[model samples]
Target chain A: MTPQELRLACRDGSFTTNTSGYCAGYVQANLVILPKSWADEFFVFAQQNPKPCPIIGFSKTPGEPVIRVGGKDVDIRSDLPQYRVWRDGELAGEPADVSDVWQDDFVTFLIGCSFSFEEALLADGLEIRNITEQVNVPMFNTNIACEPTERFYGNQVVSMRPFKAADAIRMIQICSRFPNVHGAPVHLGDPSLIGIEDIQKPDYGDAVTVNEGELPVFTACGVTPQAVIKQAKPPVCITHSPGCMLVTDIPNSKLAIF
Target chain B: MTPQELRLACRDGSFTTNTSGYCAGYVQANLVILPKSWADEFFVFAQQNPKPCPIIGFSKTPGEPVIRVGGKDVDIRSDLPQYRVWRDGELAGEPADVSDVWQDDFVTFLIGCSFSFEEALLADGLEIRNITEQVNVPMFNTNIACEPTERFYGNQVVSMRPFKAADAIRMIQICSRFPNVHGAPVHLGDPSLIGIEDIQKPDYGDAVTVNEGELPVFTACGVTPQAVIKQAKPPVCITHSPGCMLVTDIPNSKLAIF
Candidate 1:
């Protein structure tokens, strides 16, 4: 289905599944909604640490519920497939539609997701092991620290994918064009240097096969802001459930800087 | 001195040392002059294997010693600091001047060198271990086979430079812009994957320090074609002696695609 169609289905509680591989070629974003009090600090944190928290679009007015830049009639509260509600940094509930719980002071942020870059990598004929294996891409928390803003400080979270060196080089060129999607990779080669203790184990998502000759390339992940927000312990926060993203009208190609 | 002045100095027998660092910001090319009978095969080989043999300039016609595109009044026979005369794949002599041995059927080729890309990497503030160690960049004969031509076929020779993964990503971005030189690195991370037995020992040039956290990034070297030419056993061939390149008038920045 198109982004609009998929979003309409999401609004009516007819589509609660993850949004991966849906609305192909269009941008799928991680949704972050918080009170205006915390929005400014989070925005600054994103600006300071762009590799992990590259903001693509945000609602123009608090509680306005529409992200005009990413899609027409994109309802902030109900357009995403699923949302996890947080109360004081604790998982309060998982809701398919948050229209009844919407607040007039809530601000919505749309951050670029890795799905767009993975599409580009696949188009270039490089195999994505997670996609091939039908599992979530493994993610890790790293010793690399994000530039801190008041009430918004945490270690960087990264998503790992293994590739041969040559393909990894090509992937770097492809992903560099899309800085909004975490740009080029932040780390590669030995994972231990970045504090990754086990190659077969990850903090989040499923671990894929890492062949003998392949190197594990890690890119800054959008999950970082969620992790940071959890640590920051805001009064209340809402984010899309993992893999259940907010489908946008924006084309994936539109993200390429060049 | 300018490249023109350096060429003049070379012609007048006033400067005979290696040209690695002399003509900063100008292109220094690997020289290969062969008879017209063997030139077509080499040209095809170069076209087939661009990463290792990116041709920057070549003589317009047989016996045309002047490469007007690369520099003004560039005398192919004597402008370079030194030349190696080869017969039946064996080095016959090292000469400062090849003007007396130049034949009417000789065709000259100017291939891109790593000096241009190394300058780019250093400009981006990445430390080049070889440059820091004050020795030649280490090059190895790899098991990576070159695309074969009728009279030219051999394994590729690669040059190694160590960089931490993040800096290596930046280096790849910087080098991608300079395709006239060896573009982005061909392989990285694993030396044994490409048949490199020892990181400390290289087949040609000096090995630089590979720090504990750094990966040895390998790029296809201009020397691959020379090794292929040697193996092909062309009746008579002449090339620039190692470290003694043909300094050209083209600005190094002119090679950047962007």
Candidate 2:
């Protein structure tokens, strides 16, 4: 379906599943909703740690639900298939629609997700192990610390994909074109060097096979914000449910600077 | 000295030393002069294996001593600081000027050198182990074979520089912009993976320190042509002596596509 159609299905409560393969060429974004009081500090956090938390677009003003930056009819409340409500760093609820808990002082941020660059990679004929294995991309917490703000700060979280050294080089070149979506990989080759203790056991997402002759290439993950927000322990925060992203009208190709 | 001044000094039999540090910011090329009878096959060889034999420019016609493509007054016979005269694939003499050996039916080819990209890496603050250790960049014969023509067939020769994974990634990005100068690294990480049994014992050039956290990044080397020439056993071949290159008027920045 088109991005608009998929988003409309989401708005009417007919599409509660994850929006991964629904809007193929369109941009899918990780969502973060915060109060006006905490939004400025969070913006600073994203600015300082752009590789992990690149902000593609945010609400024009506090309490503004319509994200005209991505699409004309994008409603922050009902456009996403699912959202995780955070209360004091805890998972309070997983709701399909968040209009009931919407606050007048709410600010929504649309973060560039890896899905965009993943599509670019697949289009260039590179195999994504997570897609082939039918699992979420393996993600790990790294010792590489993110630049901290007054309220939000944490170690960087990275998602992994395995490729032979040559293909890994090509992946880096292709992904480098899309700076909005984490840009090039942060690390490859040795995982222990980046403080990832075990390759088979990820802190988040299902582990895929890292076959012999392959290097586990890591890119800064959008989930970093969720991890940071959890550590920061904001009184009220919201984020997209895992794998359930906001389908934007922006085409994935549009994100590539080159 | 400017590239032209250096060329003038070489032409006048004054500059007999290597051109490594001379003519900064300008292109330095590996010189290959072949008999007209052998030039066509070698051209095909270079076309099929650009990574190792990227032809920056060539004589306009057989017997042409001037290369107008890179500079206004580049005389192929004496523009380089030194030339290696090869008789039946064996080095006959290393001469400051090749005016005595200039042949009417000779075709001069200027192949891209790694020095262009090495300068780029240094400017970007990436440490080149060879430059820091004051030795030649280590080179290895890889199992990675070049696409061959009838007369020219051999495995690729790669120059190595050790860098931490992060620096290696940056090096890849920077080198990619200058495709004429070997482009991005051909392989990184394990040396044995590419059939090099000993990382410390390179087939050509000097081995530098590979620090604990650094990966030995490999780029296709211009030395591959010299190796191919040795194997092909051309009746009469000429090349730039090791570390001596043809300094051209082309600015290094002009080679960057982006």
Candidate 2 per-residue C-alpha lDDT over A14-73 given as tens digits, one digit per residue, 9 for 90 to 100: 999978887888899999999989998999999999999999999978998899987868
DockQ of each: 0.82, 0.75
- Writing each residue's lDDT as its tens digit, candidate 1 over B1-258 gives 999999999999898989988989999999999999999889999999999999998887999988898789988888988899999999999999999889999989999999999998888899999999999889998899999988899999999999999999888888889888989999999899999999899999997899899999999999998999999998899999998999999999999998
Candidate 1 structure lDDT: 0.92
Interface RMSD of 2: 0.7
lDDT (Cα, 0-100) at B91 in candidate 1: 99
Give Cα distance to truth, residue B66, candidate 1, Å. Answer: 1.4
Q: What does the lDDT read for residue B112 in candidate 2? A: 96
Report candidate 1's fraction of native contacts. Answer: 0.76
Could you tell me how far off, in angstroms, the CA of residue A149 lies in candidate 1 after the best superposition? 1.0
Model 1 bad stretches (over 4 Å): none
lDDT of 1 at B243: 89
